[model samples]
Target: MTTATGPDLRERAETVLATLAGPGARLREDQWVAVQALVEGRRRALVVQRTGWGKSAVYFVATALLREAGAGPTVIVSPLLALMRNQIDAAERAGIRAATVNSANTGDWERTYTAVDAGEVDVLLVSPERLNNPDFRDRVLPRLTASAGMLVVDEAHCVSDWGHDFRPDYRRLRQLIAELPAGIPVLATTATANDRVVVDVTEQLGLGRHDSGDTLVLRGSLDRESLRLSAVRLATPAQRLGWLAEHLDALPGAGIVYTLTIAAAEEVAEFLRERGHPVASYTGKTDPAERLAAEGDLLANRVKALVATSALGMGFDKPDLGFVVHLGAPASPVAYYQQIGRAGRAVERAEVVLLPGREDRDIWAYFASLAFPPEPLVRQTLAVLGDEPLSTAAIETRVDLSRTRLEMLLKVLDSDGAARRVKGGWVTTGQEWVYDRERHQRIAEAREVEQQAMLDYIGTTECRMQFLRRQLDDPAPERCGRCDTCTTPAWSTDVDAGTAAAAQERITRPGIEVAPRKQWPSGMAELGVPVSGRIPAAELAAPGRVIGRLSDIGWGTRLRELVDGTDPDDAPVPKDVLDACVRVLAGWGWEERPVGVVGVGSRTRPHQLDHLARRIADIGRLPLLGTLAPTGPRPEEHANSAQRLAAVWSAFEPPAFGMPAGPVLLVDDVVDTGWTATVAARLLRHAGATAVLPFALAQKG
Candidate 1:
């Protein structure tokens, strides 16, 4: 066992890098500096370099050196399972044994834990969320902190709210670092952090102080020499798809096709498959096993591409990935840079193209709506919470927030020490929590700036690479002669008519399953609703169909226009949309056809809802059973399931007479939470209707 120091340190690092990469591999100058700072100086460092600049090498090499000196295992706080798997494989290549404990591999945890405790593991990678898990935080982390030789924070930008991708879970690392023994070497690495994120992450790494001088920040040029950047503006999404259908195979090599939403990812993958391209859809909703399999297929080049959403934005490692084609631009230039950074890592030249859509800003706005809630909402949440533990669903019943927003708020509150998440649920900590209105406002404004920058990046006639690099505040931004603006587009932007037709046909093809709400939202009884659990079979609405989801690439755009762009005045449904709705009904393989139509009264689109229901009944030659009368104004918009259910529980009154004896089609302009339809169907069931089949123009994604 020997210590790694001075000249010996570089030699050890080279040996480890050669083993990790290949025989000819040697440490880059900055890579050595990072390793030396960690191994010899035992200092904290933030290494912000390009995607393929070997940041992982620094940590792995330092781990090898530190372990050789009989130090404890290096514990890496990684963000994703894919990244952990990649890191473990990379460590094994250098003869440094590594293991991980994440949600995906719970079965291996005890074994991994035993190995780590026995000093048989050289590196241990844990997800950021694990840092807050009670078992890990109370038992495992303290031990790891006491004996860990080096700490690494991968994708450290997530630690800052200012980052494009922030996770409250990453904030727990600040507490972990504060508890670490003094002088422990720490490394935070990210490829996408701008100066703001850099400052925020540096402060977190500096023992939780903004002015701590013990941290080293190594930022390099963001230029990717092997990436040929370009943007292709098409008249429509169909044209973009047509371009992909015609040219995906002609790109440099196998790569990724990015979409903004899950429906788009699945839709794009399916269309590509129809066009005889080997592709798979990957999204946050994809099964863990399927995601792993898709990742493997992409790695082996078994598929031409994996059409994916932002879920694939981080931690996927494929050095020779050939290209990245975005169907729609990401909201932020910084985020765009991070996504495209996945490509051209080891390839001589990988194609990076953006197909900016007219709908990109709409998608951006959808995400922006999920930002921090207003101060009043936060105060309301605090008022409802007490010292007693309550599940998130229980809180949702008391608050007016949707489940996602509630969870986000809770995480923020937990990070701020205003609340604590326990075994069963969350408990208020009685700590003073100030809503940082200014900070949140600044972040929101920053997001807007980033979005504008992305749009500008698409329309800019200047060097594309320079624009992106400058957005990341890269110190040495320069014109990349390879980009489309600097030179001619390396690939053709033409979309064949036949290809465009096929794409348009595929996208316009509509119908999405609107799954029934089997179980009533929990705590509904607390809200004065009679239901508390699963709806009785006799009262449950049959699973039905919508023309399409609001997130659909083709029908979605039109539906959004109809629903969001239209004035409040009542109007008949467009002929094409009505035709599409009819087609959906024709294709629905129901056990029994609806005998009548029953409309759910709508406050926002009364004329449209009534017109749609009347037309649906007339088209199907079913009787008009009459619309359900609203007992009150539309329930509070954007409320959670429990709150929504409670609000609509008795809000609709069924017709007193002329009850349908058979199945009835329940119609609405849109189904957001599905609670409105649920309550209406339940009312119809109780009103002597045999069955209720929900039909809607569109379902919100």
Candidate 2:
């Protein structure tokens, strides 16, 4: 194991801090220790500081130390554009040379390539998605790989699936780190993680010989002395609006009211505006220009209240905020904590109120259901896409469903890895699509097990926070002391029992009722040939064709002109035609399989059948399918860690004891379960390393 003499490292750290810290600046005790450890060149370190604890200062001190010691560049990998902007702004303000690369600024391929190759840039702040780009791997990472410096990952919790904000791209970071040069140190920092998340981060990062002792899990009292928390239960929307209006006048600073949906946000904002409150609304659907204007209004105190979706708070450091009101229940306690944490950032007293109603639970369940799709339908969709790109129109025709129904199925397929879209067409992306029959069956079975687990979580009778914490292997607190359950023990118990019993009844009840399918308009029958089990060609043709075809069948001249020389193939089908098809086919039970299609009436897994039925039902409800569009904003590109590592660490001090003689791995944190720690260790072993040790700023009991 590598070791550094304490006195020697402390001296170097002091020197570095003196150069970096401005006049009259002093390092906090924790920051001093963190800097000293980095000066020792431990190679793997985790820094678990509380929110607003100046965790970034540790890296700033380390960077100055490394640069003064004549080390190469260092890299910092951050997850959000807002975070990147914040760090870049701070670094520049301190007179440090720093650059930020994200989708917003680097709008095209050429700009991305140019920024990375520009050798003069010292520090780079980036998102995780950019690492997937081949250009970064080839043009930028090489310099960092060759440098002797440090690599820092901010918000390191994202690497674990158990994190509140999980992203798929984080899973690929281990492979990206493997390509870096030997003896490079890695530093990870996060404000949250309960034991398991810490271990997951270390294991996933592959830090060697770094023990849990190296981890520093800081403990802070949950009781925000400055924040006043309360919950107001309401029976109707009008009552809630009245409460909001009365409370708005009581709060003096900027306030944010979070709602369940974009529509609700607009309505609430409009209602407040009519009452003479300077209000603005922000949601995912708000146009960019309007969003910027709203943000400016809030920052300048021009707007007294801002009604928004949950997207407004991350990296927004507004200290003067007076209140944060949740118009609806947040999906999870973790989300609630993060959202409320936004207030009182300036150490000032703040108010947070949660307004809970029955509808909130349903909304949460609906979103949770979307996260896990039915495996059987997933498998079927994979088979259909089969590495081929097909438009929604073509997919609808092939699936023998209306455009609306097809679109819904496609959404489920995309989420479950059964399909992916490229250039507005779908393509298969799952292993089942390429596997042999037996293996494919095995994959389907495994998925069934996972699906059942997800359903169990959704239908649980226990405290929701407790259930989630257990899933992540973090020990549940005796009581959260803040969630709805803890706030009103009896009500929580009764609600849990009622919801559980209701879920059981819903599961055991008979299938949902379906309305009768509508008949095709007149003259549709003559448009095309009849295919067994398929909707007639007449049903697929436009109303005009149906009329003309009926006239051709001797209905009369009025119907003849309706069809008017149009080819049956070219006729437009009425929107309702597809809607009806979805309802009837989905309700009747339809399945897509490799051997042949099976109906819901066949003996398939119950959950699979339910999902298929739901997909069809959703499709039928859709107004139009052929012209569906991607809904969210374009995804942002990630950053290159190796390059950033080299730039930042080039100046870091070597370990006071010197680098280890053999191959060494490095990591940032560790927790009790060791899920992340084990994963990182295994990856290092696979990469031909001699030893893989885990390190962190703190360890949970």
Among the numbered candidates, top TM-score falls to 1
Residue-wise C-alpha lDDT for candidate 1, range 1-701, written one tens digit per residue: 45757887788788889999999898888998898988888888899998878999999999989988888999999999998889888999999999999998899999998999999999999998887677888789999999999999999998887887888888778877888897689999999988888888987555444346667888898898998999999999899999999998889779999999999999999999999999999999999999999999999999999999999978898999999999999999899999999999888999999998998888899999988889999999988887788988998888889888888788778767898888888888999988888988999999999898998999999998889888899744467899999997776777899999999999999788888999988887788887777789988998878988888888888998788736666678999999999999999888888878999887777888899999999999999889998887666665678887787888877666588688999998888888888888888898888999999888898
Model 1 scores what on Cα lDDT? Answer: 0.88
Instruction: Give me the candidate number with maximum lDDT.
Output: 1
Candidates' TM-scores? 0.97, 0.56
After superposition, candidate 1 runs with Cα above 4 Å error:
207-212, 475-477
Residue 80, model 2: lDDT of: 66
Can you write out model 2's per-residue Cα lDDT over 397-426, one digit (the tens) per residue? 334333433555565344334566566477
* Regions of candidate 2 where Cα sits further than 4 Å from its true position: 1-23, 107-118, 134-148, 204-223, 377-701
